[model samples]
Target chain A: QQPVQSPQAVILREGEDAVINCSSSKALYSVHWYRQKHGEAPVFLMILLKGGEQKGHEKISASFNEKKQQSSLYLTASQLSYSGTYFCGTEYNNNDMRFGAGTRLTVKP
Target chain B: EAGVVQSPRYKIIEKKQPVAFWCNPISGHNTLYWYLQNLGQGPELLIRYENEEAVDDSQLPKDRFSAERLKGVDSTLKIQPAELGDSAVYLCASSPGGRWGNEQFFGPGTRLTVL
Candidate 1:
């Protein structure tokens, strides 16, 4: 099954902070995040593995709670370039990956 | 290294017509996936291939949808007698094998418009 993301849409100004959450109904071995801009392909952002392993860029950070089957992406001091749709992908034991509906974020100056 | 490559960035077809989209994965990548995305939504997996062998296709509508990855390099997805509901973007992604849960590289995707 696909994961669930909260806050269908978010509008923020430059230097603001926001959090996007993703929850899965089943056990997840890993959580992947990607961002897609208008008229473009989805770009890989980060991946959080079970046992508290996180791999991503310094500009962005995320956390995964295995017991809760949830993950959160944190964007601090948002910039206009951050405007796009964020998708959270959940991977099960079988290596099947499913993505959430997505969270649309618009950052303005 | 070059990223995933897809052809026919935009295609417009009438209902009941046939359409095909192609994709070439990055060098030496053995895992390929096809996804469908509608407006204002995230991508939905249609099929997954592990070195030319389709490992997962539960989400694919086999009756009209078919795909092939030859020699585990390039892939082609076809829709016979397309329906208006099939109008959407078709994305192809790939990842290096030998490890599970690796990050995937996606192509620009082909925008299909069925009229």
Candidate 2:
């Protein structure tokens, strides 16, 4: 099943922070985060395995809770280049990976 | 270290016409996937192939949509008698294997417009 993302859209100023959440109804084995710019394909960001772990990328970080089947992405000190649509994909049981609707984030100076 | 590559970035065709998109995955990647993304929606898997074998294609519309990865390196997705609803972005992704957790590289995607 497809994951559900919260806060359909968000606008932030440079150096601000934002959080996007994704939840699934099924037992999640892993969660993947990606960002897509308009007219471009989605870019892989980071992946969190089923161990309720957290990973960081530069200033971006994410936490996954296997028990709740939820994951949250955190963008710290957001930069203008961070403007794009963010999606969280969840993998359940087997190799099935489903993406969320997406959250559009606009970062301005 | 090139990423996945897709051709004919944009295409336009009338209903009932046929359209095909090609994709080349990253070298050494053994798993490939095709997904359809509609406007304002997330991508949905159309098919998945492990090397030259199609291990999962249940979501593919076998009636009008067909896909093949002949050499296990390059793939082609075809839509016959295309319908208006088929207008969307087709994305190709590749990963090392199913054991790899959510680490897939994507192609630029081919946008198709059906009139």
Candidate 3:
């Protein structure tokens, strides 16, 4: 099943901090994070395995909690280039990855 | 190495017409995936292939949709009779097989418009 993302959309100014969360009903074995700009493909950000460790990609970071079957993406000091739609793809049983509805992030000047 | 590549970046067809989208994943990448993204939604997996074998296709409609990945390199996704509701972006992604944290790289995607 698809995961659920909170704060469907968020608006932030450059240097602002924002957090996007992805939660699934099923147990999550792995969680993948990606970002897509308008009319573009979703680019790989990072992937978190069962263990609840934090991952960082430039100014963007993510944390995965296997116990709660949830993952959170943290955008620290957001930049204009950070404006896009963020999706968390949850993997179960080591198989196909299912994506969340996505959280649209807008970083204005 | 180049990233996953998709062709006919944009396709416009009338309802009931057949349309096909093609993808060429990064060389040496054994896992290929085809996904559909509706407006304001994340990419949804339609099919996945490991090398030349289709390992997962459970979510595929199977009625008017069919996909094939020949030679375990390039793949094709075809819609026999398209409907207006089929208008969306078709994405292709690939990963270097599967390990603990292999991240899938995506292509530019094909935008399908059914009138």
Candidate with best TM-score = 1
Query: Per-candidate interface C-alpha RMSD?
Result: 1.1, 1.2, 1.0
The positional error of residue B95 in candidate 1, measured at the CA in angstroms, is 0.6
Clashes of 2: 0
Better of 1 and 2 by DockQ: 2
Candidates sorted by DockQ, best first? 3, 2, 1
The segments of candidate 1 whose C-alpha lies over 4 angstroms from its true place after superposition are none
Q: Which pairs clash in the backbone of model 3?
A: none
What TM-score does each model's chain B reach against the true chain B? 0.96, 0.96, 0.96
lDDT of 3 by residue, A1-109 (tens): 9999998999999999999999999998889899999999998888888866544476667888778888889899989999999999988867579999999999999
Q: CAPRI verdict on model 1?
A: medium
lDDT tens readout by residue for model 2, A1-109: 7899998999999999999999999999889999999999898888888865544366678988888889999999999999999999898855678999999999999
Instruction: Answer with 1 or 2, whichever has the higher TM-score.
Output: 1
Worst 10 contiguous positions by lDDT, candidate 2 chain B? B96-105
lDDT of 3 by residue, B1-115 (tens): 7888899999999999999999999998988999999999999999999898999999898999999998999999999899999999999999886464358889999999999
| Alpha-carbon shift of residue A87 in model 1 (angstroms) | 0.2
Q: Write the per-residue lDDT of candidate 1 for residues B28-92, one digit (tens) a residue.
A: 88889999999999999999999989999999999999999989889999999899999999999
Give me candidate 3's TM-score against the actual structure. 0.96
